[model samples]
Target: MLVYFRLLSESFRFAMNALRNNKLRTLLSLLGVTIGIFSIIAVLAAVDSLDKKITKDLSSLDKNTIYLMKMSFGPSEIPQWKREQFPNVKYDEYLYLKGAMTNTDQMGYQIFTKSESLKYGSNTVTSVNVVPVSHEFIDIQGLEFDEGRFYTESEANSAAPVVVIGNEIAKSLFEDSEPIGKKIRMYGQRFTVIGVLKKQGSGMFGNDDSSAFIPVNFVRQQFGDNNKGLVNVIIFKPEKGVDMDAYKAEISQKLRAFRGVKSGEIDNFFINVFSGFTDFIDGIISQMNVVGWIISGFSLLVGGFGIANIMFVSVKERTNLIGIQKSLGAKNRFILFQFLFEAIILSVIGGIIGLLLVWIIAMILTKALDFEFVLGMGNILLGTGLAAIIGLISGILPAISAAKLDPVEAIRTGM
Candidate 1:
């Protein structure tokens, strides 16, 4: 054990000496490994961060939550023309489902409409996302409030001129003043702000921070109940441990009956499950992982070749020293380990530099974009382990050659 430790120590010193003596050559040789590590680690970090953010953004809602709408969230066999001709989900249907659906934990109705400008006195914010939803939306989506509260059921039913603003909208429109109870102008009318959502950072879909929520009834009043452009959806959260397939069947049958659809006709509306959407996201992440590995694998191959070249050169340069050590009763294993450790040290150092660069860039991106970029322990360990493996693979042949060299022949050749 002590001898092995001494061998490692001596190898480390030799590796340092190589770096010190041939700085430019060493750097050039390690460049491929550095870039390879950087490419792989950067891609992995980005994918991980994206996955985490998506999960965090959707964490508040149950995965079993379902959206019933004219459009499908995932790819569908239905053509666009047929989907377009399909009637929009109406308030009556939402009411019917809300009251009639069994095995349901909660349900809400919402409308997706065009972006609208909001005015608070002389201050104006343009192109803000307008989400007109029922009071039940708060419970269904599990929205958190920074101040005040969501509209009451009565308020939503009555189409009251009250609004809930997101954090960015509140900050932009009201500045330092308390936003609650402040009236904002939209749809050519004054609406009082009743709630402010917590600051949710940028997301994959869109930032919720610059959005405003109002009563769906208000939207119905303005756009009328049958407005073709006003897309409506009914969201449902199923009870925990319930059979999703059975629940979906129940929903389909009820809606088909409610819509007076006859047998053998396809259902007009689509039922999109949140879990299906997450599965789509997972597929995308997997594709990204495959692409990252393929691209980075080339770099690693080049890096391996570079390390092998350097190891061969190292063997040639230290032939005399190796011969002397063997003449002094040093074993074959000692000579092999000496070169092997030097190669591993070189690769690991390059990998460390690459990781450091990734960390710095992650910090910069997190601050600049206001999105958290996580570099987890697992990824770090994976990177280091890959580097070590690359080192070992690249060093093996050279180490063996060095170990097998005849002492007298090696000494004579070096002289």
Candidate 2:
């Protein structure tokens, strides 16, 4: 064990000396490995970060949440003209589903509206996302309050002029002052600020920090049921551990019967399950991973070739030294292991530099953008493993050639 350790130490010293003496060559050799590590690791980090954000955004909602509407979340067989001809989902339909649907935990009615401005005395917030939803939305969306509370069911049913503002809107309009019981103007009507939403950063749906929710019935009362500007949807969150297929079937059948659609005819509305939408997103992410790996694999290939080239050159330069070591009875395996370890060390050094670059940029971008960029431990381990494997493969043949050198012939040639 001691003899082997001494041999390893001698090999380490030799490898360091080579690096010190051939600075330019060593740098040129490591450049490919560095770029390759950077390329592969960067791609992995980006995809992983995106996946994390999506998960975080959807964390509060049950994966089985259903959207009952006319528009499909994914590609559909229905033609554009046919889908256009379908009637809009109504408030009555929402009430019917809310009452009739079984195996359901919660259901809420909501209307999609265009961006509108809100006014509080002199301070005005422009282009605010105005979500008009029923009182049930509070439970369905799992909304938490920073101050005050979501509108009561009676307030929604009566179409009362009460509003819940997002954290950003609250800060902009009121600053340090109390916002509850204050009045704001929107749609040419005075609405009392009854609630304030907790600060949620930018998300896939929209930033809760800059959005507001009002009673869905309030919009219905103002525009009537036939308002062309509003798109109505009923959100359903099913009970956990229920058979999903049967649950969706039950929803479709109930709507079909209520609409008087013939058994042979296709249902006019879309049943967009939240889980299905996420599965579609997952498929896209998988494709991105494949494409990224293919592109980065080319960089790694070039990097491997560069390392191999350097190892061959090193063997040639130290031919006389290798010959003397063999004459002193150094084992072939020792020579092979020495070269292999040197190659691995150099490759690992390059990989570390690449990882460091990723970490620094990840921090900078996270600060600059609303989205967070993460370089997880799994990716770091993967990068290191790839570097070591490249080194072992690249160094093998060169190490073998050095180990097999004829000592007498090598010494004479050196002279």
For residues 1-415, could you state the per-residue lDDT of candidate 2 as single tens digits? Answer: 9877877687667667767998888878888888889888888999999999999999998889999998898899999999987777999988898889998998999899899999988999999999999998989988989999999999999999999999999999998999999999999999999999999888977888898899998888878877767788889989989898899899999999999999899989999999999999999888998888898888778888877888888888888888888789888888888888777777777778788888888999999998899999999999999989988888889888888889887777666
Candidate 2 structure lDDT: 0.88
User: Model 1: per-residue lDDT, tens digit, 165-249?
Assistant: 9999999999999999999999999999999999888777667799899999999999898888888999998989999999999
Poorest stretch of ten by lDDT in candidate 1: 199-208
Model 1 pairs in collision = none
TM, every model = 0.95, 0.94
Off by over 4 Å in 1: none
Best by lDDT: 1
Residue pairs clashing in model 2 are none
Worst 10 residues of 2 by lDDT: 10-19
